[model samples]
Target: MAWWKLHKRDKPGSPTGAGGAVLASAAIITRDQVRSVVGKGQEWQAQAWDFYRTVSELKSGVRWAANGCSRARLYIGRVDPDGSSSPTPVDAQAEDLSPDLVARLLAPLEELAGGQLGQSEMLRRFSVHLDIPGESYLVGFDDPTSGDRRWLVCSPSEVTSAGGGGTIRVQLPESQSARVELSLDDCTLIRLWRPDDEYAYLPDSPLNGLQDPLRELRGLTSHVLATVDSRLAGAGMGVMSDDVVPASPQQTDGANPVHSDPVTAALIEAMAASLRDRDSASALVPLLLRVPGSVKDKFEWHSFATELDSNLLPLREAAIKRLAIGLDMPPEVLTGLADTNHWNAWIISDDSIKLHLEPKLGLIAEALTDRYFRPAWEALGVPDPEAWACWYDTSDLKQRPNRAPEAAEAHARGAISDAAYLRELGFSAEDMPDEDEQRRRLLIQLATTNPQLAPAALEALGVRLPNIGQGAATDAVRAPVEISRVAPAVEAPARNEPPALPIAASAVLDDGWRMACLDLAARRALARAGNWLLSRSGRSRRGELAHVPVHEVHMHLSPDQADLAQMLDGAYRDFHAATPGETDLHAAVDLYVRRLLLTGIAHERGLLAGHLAAAGCDRAAA
Candidate 1:
């Protein structure tokens, strides 16, 4: 067989390797030996037949048979996941066998099975690491010529060299049972005198090999073994495949095993029913939206679902009514919710809940329908229900101060202010894509410029105003004005120290003379007639011709200087007028007086305050 080719250099299988060598030795034995030494009935027969088959296969090559005979031995030990020496195997299933007998069988194996082979090679040779100490193995051989399957029981006597362990040999009685109990500690290793190299033997084939049959068997066995390993690793206690096995229970919560436990099935049904009965659901809604096929098998769960189906109309009505009341809407306006099936269908749909909630929105609906209202106007950034109640003292967003005006106004005006408020709250006009900015602007203009509004209030409202966290308000630029800083004119004596004047010109000058001169100067000034000699004295040009300043001042002025400056302005104006666009001293003085009068009038009227301030003006400047 192909397995024989792979084992060409090593001793083959369990106690039978030593049995084959004994067959080669021509030892004599009996059928009672076969039964007592190997095992009973078919077990003994199978071992004997296998030993005979092995001998037949080796008989073709004397050299191969000689090599196998010299290297013959068998050993069994437990392996862990890490491929470490698992010195002792914990008893997963305790039996009623005597403890002392089990102990005496195991101590020798523990001392003998150490560092004989690499971990990987040992595992590759044996499919499972037999629990040597906690398991038992009865090993011996049969004589071929005698046709005897008699075998000897083996145990450790003492540890000799670190490599060579002395073992006890027991020749069994013909009447004894052959099946030995195995624990990790009660394991054994067979050794023999040979003329060739020593060989390590495994009872079972390894997991992966050129041998196809064993490879498949190893795959299934290893998977089961790994599961057991995992359970043992988790808890200190070990379990067998038959104990705590998978029950194939019904799937609930997507994790429970399926169709096994009645109580678990009932609990799952009740849970699913309660979830279905919920009026409002959030994150878990998606999970329950499509019930799992496994849960559908639970009749009680399906029965609970039936109750929900029958009562759905009232449930839908109650849910819609609650949403409407929260929205401060009347039930009639939201009649679309009366169809429970449609509502339920929409509930499970995507963000399309917007479509279902549309009719019930009331004021939100009106604002949304308006061409001037932006979609953002619906965002109303009203805090959530909890916050809304804490802040506004009610969950009703309609009763909010800003939204209160939405009800009284027609759809146009209501949409306008609503849109504006949302924009002020930081929403963009695009958020209300249906609403046009033109109508919004027009509404604002009408509110500010209406003839019916109070003038002052309307004026204040004409400018664009900033809202919270917005840019500064626009303001008008005003010109600055300069006020006279000098004290008002008061009388002061002339350097000449002249006598004080009378109250009237007649008291100082002769009445007849004062009247004749005032009348003559008034006529001369109007007629553009006067001498030019008095122009150099710095007297007014109008005064030089009109003589009014002289007439009034005669009472306040000394008589000696009165005649010192006389009508010379007219001649000066005439001389300056001779040159094109050039004014003489007299004309310039008169022009200056006229300019002053105009500027003073504007200052008194408060027209140039900012302009004068900008120009660095003093009291006389504007």
Candidate 2:
């Protein structure tokens, strides 16, 4: 369905557009019917699974880890022979794919088993099981022979090896048991990084290291709950003298019997009973203990000694940090939201994705490719399943600043060229016109300066003058080059276009040395201004220039484009600053025109800034 699939080269006898179809195949069928497993297989690992289940259910670090991973995007990508060799809006779409085969390959993953769970949500639950038990199982039954199949995530409890290598028995949800072929023929094992490389069956969970801290936390939570309950029940026990007997058997308002001997219990219980349905806004509740002799003098009440669990929250935070570290995520990402700012948050997330999440996602992708995708392809007559497989896009996790406006401003200032500007926006500059506008504008300025010139004179300078009533305006850039009645540029237009100047105006300027000096000065100033044209090449013998490195463009520059354009502009304005004011009338007019023509020629942006370095002096004539 993707656009890049169109360029497939048709080979004789090959199926129509089948080259890019293997990876793009939507549904994979397998002969070994899969049975979705529910498990309780490892009794030795029960405690760890319990830890995972408890924390995952509660508002804890495991929940944070799950939420962080749920944003991942999973898609199948494969290289096409006709893949895009140019820039694409999204960097993830490396190439194009074939639709027919790709659709079949992709069919099962669209709904991802049972029409509810998508790939991301599946991975989320999968990650939780993996992180908690250090091992997770999946049984995908894509029975080409059957009408039903389920890609199921299994618990560490109900699934286990069935006495033999590469065989697993799953306790199905239907309360039936089935033996699964274990080379991912029917079931797959997705596990964490185990230090014991030899024993793939038993992997280590982060909870193993967190056991002591968690146990202490549970104890702390229990103690606090007990303290609160004690407080709620009259805040303490009441001690009464034993000799004091009740006048009569006492009863609460609800007819519950109260032992008359313990007047404190009678009083407190009576108080509690009266307030059960009382108006919450009213602070008063009356209790009649009905104790015989002066009970207040005989009875004494003492509140239990209790201390606050101030370290509970701090300890919980420490536990979350350990979990984050175990999961290879930034601690700040887990529980440090208040401390994160907009600027550093993006950086932290980018680092977390690159360093931690990438490898985990890779493992899951590989498992899916091998156990699910490849087999389905094999059934569908795909000879090479490796060509197309599952891969993840963490683009959602990629946070970056948009510098579009800044890039536009810089390009307008000529600190960057059109190609550089296009590259800034992830666009290709390949088809842009090669013509220079700056040089074209210079030609227009020269011809418009004097309306007195003949039609033939305009042609002599290679100027395409506008129609009769169409007046034009142009800025005359002046540079101090010596002049002797050389009022027009002749012999060559000195641009990418073919020659246009006429032969009648071909008289060389008397002072050639002054024109050369002006050209040399302009080049020097431009070089000082960062030799911007050279940098615009975006590369040099030093490997890459300031332009080649997109991320590094704003970091460093020698003179840069803005400075080059600005300095070259100043050089033009100075060219005619030396036109003598003490000349005779005719000679002064000739000198002004001559210098104007020279300065305009110098300001030309085409063919090496009016061909100053190579042929500017040679191209200019009277």
Candidate 3:
């Protein structure tokens, strides 16, 4: 005996199984028993199974619909505490945890849905809740040996709700045929459904509600498929009927005559075989049908082909539209029939996202927030878990045909802030400048353009400046005064005092004296012009010419002083054209004055020295 035949056969009812036959029989009996148990709730369960099977058959289309509906981003936000029901930015800690939690949830979902799945897959799996009454999942460790847990979305068939929806029993076939019964409170599951009054145990799915339309769609699709097969099979090909040739050419005898001679028949067979053998590598090869020479002129080949009508297209499209209506999805999305114009496309996309996708996303988001986010945040010690909620940010996903121009107009009209406008344009918070920073920049710009307003701006900002003088001086001084005064004052006579010198004596100045006085005035004006040039140079060198005030060097100069002032201004500008760094304007003016005074003194000294030298030379000659 072989080793395989050594074991003894066990009885049917016995637990012990030594033979493979007993094990095989037990497996068969167990499957049959499971089926028998499942068959007890025949009517509703059978309908549910039918829907599941139909969805499976249309898996690609169903998946596409689900994905199109789920292509929106979800974010965590804080619920307003004042009962406004408005969302606010999440608290710092919750905001920090949101991305990690989102990533953690997404990673496993992608793994479960295969790595190609994204936010769309997460919502698609949750969409099963829309197809079935509800879905239950086992939230357990990803690795049974490890403590880390994840949600495994299971089929409705795998879970059996019992005790009038109090406790649910889950049978894990992969885990030693384990059966676990859990109370509603203990079960960690998310249920997504549309509310209605019809069913008591579970809500009705879109699948159930739209069953008739779906059936019609299925029938239409079958008809289209059949039509395509028929066209491919025979409609496009020409068939030579027995009566296609004139009756005069056919034999009148009751006995059937051969349709064609051996060579023609062989050619016809070859053509038919070529057409039928579609899988053959040479199916596309050109074929030639030859007729015998004696009968060729007498016979004519008459070909007939069934006409393919365009009428079915509209009917099939109408059926698809009905199916789309039933699914609560846009027809364009499901059928891939789109409007050519950008405006129409945008309108359709916007309507679908707002009217269809958002509501569905909201259901999923609420469920996940309650079942997944709350517990996770609580575990991480986040505060006020009740106030925190998850929501979909469909703003980015929505098509905005007029957003650019609208945002620009709103910004120009001061209807929205710069940051808000940028956000509408899809800029993130981190990418925009803060309001306070923007205000500060604006103030700086205003001050640069109008330096006289700098003091007022600083005062508004609550800056305190040192008092120039006490009460009297504060009243007297109305503007900022320069530290150095370049212009000489011509003081008026006191009220009661007489002129310093007799009016006649003051007027009786010599021509030489008047010329000398005019010369001094000219030098003074030149010095002032030099000072203005130096100030300009300083401002330019500091790279703050826009910020610096323009000094009017010729302000106090008389009409007679204009020529020398303009000449000196031009000369000074030309001299310092290439000079770098800030020039000391006051210093430049003082240096010019000292040089002018010293030049006169030097001339007088030179005259004295020349006279002394002449006297010494005379003494030496004597």
Candidate 4:
């Protein structure tokens, strides 16, 4: 239960001692709540968070995704491999990351993520805060030992303000009367971007974009619960009039007479839990009832799952897929690996690091580098402070299970190539293992085997094995790091200023707009879909501009080829039948639709103009 030395305001989580009384009672009054001190705002709304008890979609997906990036072993400062000050030795065992200062940073990072329990405990809270709220206000505290700053990850809602000159005002937990204004030298803010909003003071969570799907998920969940209750009540539903009573906890004491129905409810709940698998062959979900003798005859024994499974369970998966898309994660990452084969599951693990984790870890690492660690480095009067970048090693994320047997089987059956087999067994293409290690237990069968040597096998493929002579493995300080996995945190270029995109189709072309019947409901859905599309398709739309013809660009931008146009069309169809109502999302929807439509129109215009200019140049030459 080693805790990060957080600000004094974070006392509620502290062990009962000096701050015991405060921990028991003090309430955190944040900046959002401070607005209500003078005005009569919604007391419950201000006091409580968006979700008092987060369950299902938001809780599960966010936490699962966050876990991938939670245990980031952050290192700062990079020295060139060829440069002075601890250059990588001539041997293979040399440390890739030079400068002992950079290496020593791991200790403090471990302590920072180490919350009341273990290393990941604090990081889990930090990651959850970032994932759910879309922001983590890391209030910096000066480390007396290292002369650096360590941060306590605070909720965005809890921080009243983080203004100029390192002033971070945090809402004190428990029943604290006043907010605590901690005068700090450094504060790092990690923000997940809100779509099309460059100037928003508050950022958005990955969950924020998936609001509609989440609402559907929640609504569907409630509908399922109500349906279950209806079904459960329907069991002895009409027969409850005799001596039977709906048992409360007090009514259902310990014995079957007092609380047999709740126990029956518990059994039914367990049965329902077991049937969540989409491919479950179990058609009949049995409902056993314990009731009074008068009601026993009327009680209908039924299995609701097989009957209703086709209608409902798949809808939940659709919502879950929406969550996965919004989070930029693979659907299997959220739902579980039940649907995928073993090789695909293995590929998913690797893809989890590439698709999902790298971006998040890079963001966090960059923020820590720029604001948290760099400031401390500058304060120490170190030169080239900004040159030092916070980098992450995700060696831990790569769980290297013994895949040799699987690889051997696959390769033996000609299902995979030699290189693929070696890679499957966790050996890199460049720096690979020896003959015996690569062959596993099959070194004795080299004569029986086709390739007589791992070295000779690789030799045929033009891969030269580095001769370490002997004792080279024990001499290396750092393990042969996959250089791809070890990289500097790259901060995305400033996109605050709006890109000069094309005009909207609805406004320009008389018949350009595809969604003619879009109302408020469709508008929100359109906006969500448009934003989802925009978030994935980044600023590099012009990549195809150089190679392809102008007509191809138009076709690419068209609804047939353009993903945004397709998304807008789908959203309209999905929500066209909905009861319309106005929301702030509609405003964003309008903006996004315009932007998405205009982008294509704009590109077409530019390309057309260029094509005409090229033709004119040829005609003038003629």
Best by TM-score: 2
Off by over 4 Å in 3: 1-65, 68-89, 92-121, 128-142, 157-187, 195-197, 209-310, 332-340, 366-391, 399-622
Q: After superposition, how far is residue 453 of candidate 1 from its true place, in Å?
A: 99
C-alpha positional error of residue 299 in candidate 4 after TM-score superposition, expressed in Å? 16
Candidate 4's TM-score: 0.41
Per-model CA lDDT versus the true structure: 0.28, 0.48, 0.46, 0.46
Arranged by TM-score with the best first, the candidates are: 2, 3, 4, 1
Instruction: Estimate, for each residue in 97-167, the C-alpha lDDT of model 2 and write its tens digit.
Output: 45566566565456354533456667777667656666666555444346355556666665555543345
Between candidates 1 and 2, the TM-score winner: 2
TM-score of each: 0.12, 0.50, 0.44, 0.41
- lDDT (C-alpha) at residue 589 in model 4: 36
Q: Report the lDDT tens digits of candidate 1 across residue range 563-601.
A: 222332232344334333322222322222222222221
- Model 3, span 1-622: residue lDDT tens: 2111111123356543221222111111122233232213324435655655664333444565467656665556667778575455444345456676545433332332233334455666666545554333333223334433334454555566554434555665568576666543433433334554564324455556656655665666666555543422332332332333322222234565534555444334434544566565333333323333444455344322234335656766676666666665566765775445865788777777777677767766665565455545554445566667766666656757557666776786799887878877878778877788787777765454343576676666666767754443321123422222244222223334442432233222333453343334334444555355444343344354344322223322222221232334333343334332213322233233333222221112222222223323111222
Tell me the spans in candidate 4 whose CA falls farther than 4 Å from its real position. 1-52, 77-122, 142-150, 161-181, 185-201, 231-310, 336-339, 403-622
| TM-score, structure 2 vs. true | 0.50
CA displacement after TM-score superposition, residue 381 of candidate 4 (Å):
3.5
Q: Which ten residues in a row have the lowest lDDT in candidate 3?
A: 23-32
lDDT of 1: 0.28
Lowest-scoring 10 consecutive residues by lDDT in candidate 4?
481-490
Winner of 2 and 3 under TM-score: 2
Candidate 4: tens digits of C-alpha lDDT, residues 162-210: 5544455666444567455655323333322222255344444565566
